[model samples]
Target: IAKIYTDKDASLDALKGKKIAVLGYGNQGRAWALNLRDSGLDVTVGLERQGKSWEKATKDGFTPVKTDEAVRNAEVIIFLVPDMIQRTIWLEKVKPNMKKGADLVFAHGFNIHFRMIEPPADSDVYMVAPKGPGDTVRDYYVAGGGVPVLVAAYQNVSGKAMEKALAVAKGIGATRSGALESSFKEETETDLVGEQTILVGGIMELMRASFETLVEMGYQPEVAYFETINEVKMIVDIIHSKGLSGMLRAVSDTAKYGGMTVGKKVINEDVRKRIREAAERVRDGQFASEWVEEYNRGMPTVVNGLKEVDNSLEQKVANELRDLIERGKPKK
Candidate 1:
């Protein structure tokens, strides 16, 4: 079994007294900076421009510095910028100014695993990927709980990479939940596969297909939205807190029987084959290459896809329903 760590398995000693720089001040960066500071660690926020993120850092009590300057002064640097921009920033700003033996950290293994941002051999390279969004991570930490995280070491020049990784995880309160030991490749490939097969792509497509089917069957769009979209959250919440069988037990007998008997037929061998194909694309680097190429060409496909979704009948119905629901809510 893979190693699992809790608060008892980690300590902040490895990170104590070290100057840590958090680049980006965006989603993951802001959370990491705040959590580390609350944990009594020195954290410096780095930004490429004096924009909204820079202002946010200042409002949060950080004297944000330029990316290169932060790299020059830190013993540890965490790259939390978007994946598409990391390679450019590393080559131009971080790589030139980073301390020779400074530790490099990441929230995801994408850049490293795909060889988009290769760190120097003299530095320790590791990852501490929280298993949820940054806001969720921070909220859970504040509630005296934590989101679980995966910790991995890509390189161990310092011979203590894993120790430092665990310390970083602890500082961010991830050890309060659990820290699962992993490798860069395992974390990267699995994350990609899950996102494509279940989390983002699969779920969106499933919802769209269900909504279309209900509409095609002559159901009222409002009723279809409630059944196919709105109630998904309720079911998902139950499944998240309990097991699949628990969810089945909680629902009506009709639901349980129909779901068990018909769900498999809907998601059968053909669907499984498509999911496997998606996983293969991720593992074989085809998806990465396509994504990078799309990014380089200014993300036309992504932009157009979003526009298509925005103009869809389903989206229009969703917006109207959401507004109606909001208007009905009692004022605070």
Candidate 2:
């Protein structure tokens, strides 16, 4: 069985007096900075430019500093910047200014696993990846709960990398939920595979295809949207809070029977094969290479894809339905 850690398994001693620098003031960075400080750890927010992020950090009561300056003074440095920019920032600012043997932290293993941002051998490289978005993480922490997290160590030059990782997880309130021990490769590959196969790509395609099928079958677009898209959240919420069988039991007998029988027909062996192919692309680094290349070329594919989605009939229908629903809601 995989090792699971709780609040009892972690200690803040490793981070008590350490000067921690959090690079970026975006979603994850802001959450980490706030949570760690709330846990009584010293945190410095670092930004590349004195722009909106810097202003936001200052508003949050952090003495924001330049990236290089933060790295130079900190014993621990957390990189919360976007993956595409990490390599450039590390090379130009962090790598040159980071203190020797400083603990390097990450929320995801992408850059490290892909060798896009390789830390020095002397540093303690680790990850404390919360299992949710930054806003969710912060919300749970404030509510006296926490999102689960994955803890991993890449390099342990300090011989206490895992300890420090757990400590960071605790500081962020992740230990309140649980921290599952993982590795860089495992976390990176699984995250990519899940995102491609189900979370982002698969779900969107499923909804779009379902909507198109209903529309082609002569159903009203609004009705199709309600059935194929809007009710997904309600069903997913049930599944999230309960097990699959529980979700099945909660629905109508017709739904249970139809979903169990016909659902597999829709997502049959061909779909499984395609999903496996996507996993292979992620495992073999093909997806990473393609994404990196796309990013370098200014993300034309991503931009055009978003534009296509924005102009889609499904999106237009969704917007109209949402506006109508909002207008019908009783005002306070």
Candidate 3:
């Protein structure tokens, strides 16, 4: 069984009296900064001054400061910036200013696990990754609950990095739900594999293929949209709240029978091979290196691909369906 920690298993004492700096004000950064503050921790948002994030953070009641300044003053520094830019930021900004004996944290293990951002030997390194989107993280916290989190330690100069990581998890309300202990290697590898498979690439391809197949078979565009895309959320909600078996049981007998019999046929050995290849690329750092290079080159491939998809017939159908749904919503 997985070793899970709840609120009862964690304490905020480890993080007490430490000044925390949340670098970057993007999705995870904003949510974590607010949640930590609400949990009674002294939190400061660190970002580039005069940027939109600085203004937004200030409006949210935080005195946003420069990244280096924040690092200099903070005892616990959370690197919540984009993974692609972390090496540059850490080498030029954070590493030079961070105080000795402080703790360095991350919401993802990508940079650390890949050796992109190596901290000093004196500082502790750990991660507290909420296993959900930033909006859900904040929403659950506001509802007096929390999304699950994965905590891991890479270095433990103080011999209490795990305790501090768990405390950070608790402060963000993750312990209200549950937290599982993990390692940087495990988290990074699994996260990348999932993203490249079921979560992102597989889901997108499946939905698009389903929609195209329906449309090619003379189904109406709106009907195809409803069948292939719109109902995914409902199915996913069932699977998420209960489980796959629950979802199968909840659906019609026809659906249950059809899905069980044909699912493997659709995603058989060939598909599994491709998924393993993708995972291998991620595990070997090929994907990470290529992605960083693409990012550094202004994401030309990504932008062009997105442009093509934006112009696709499926996107057109999706846009119309979205507008129709919006127009039909009851007035507030």
Which 10 consecutive residues of model 3 have the lowest summed lDDT? 323-332
Per-residue lDDT of candidate 2, residues 1-332 (tens digit) = 99999999999999999999999999899999999999999999989998999999999899898999999999999999998999999999999998888889999999999999878989999999888999998899999989999999999997899999999999999999999999999999999999888899999999999999999999999999989988898899889999798799889999989999999999999999999999999999999999999999999999999999999999999888887767866797
lDDT of each: 0.93, 0.94, 0.91
Give model 3's TM-score versus the native structure.
0.97
Candidate 1 residue-wise lDDT at 111: 96
- Number of the top lDDT candidate: 2
Look at candidate 2 and tell me the lDDT of residue 253.
97
Per-residue lDDT for 1-332 in model 3, tens only?
Answer: 78899999999999987899999988888889999999999998988557888887888899998999998989999988888878888998888888887799999999999998877888899999989998889889999999899999999989999899999999989999999999999899999999879898889899999999999999998898888888898899999999998998899999988998899999999999999999999989999999988998999999998998899888998887897877866797
**Model 2: worst 10 consecutive residues (lDDT sum):** 321-330
Error of 1 at 112 (Å): 0.6
* Each model's Cα RMSD: 1.6, 1.7, 1.6
What tens digits encode model 1's per-residue C-alpha lDDT throughout 178-229?
9999999999999999988889888888999999999999999889888888
lDDT of 3 at 244: 93
Model 1 alpha-carbon drift over 4 Å, by segment: 323-332
Task: Look at candidate 1 and tell me the lDDT of residue 201.
Answer: 84
Clash count, one per candidate:
0, 0, 0
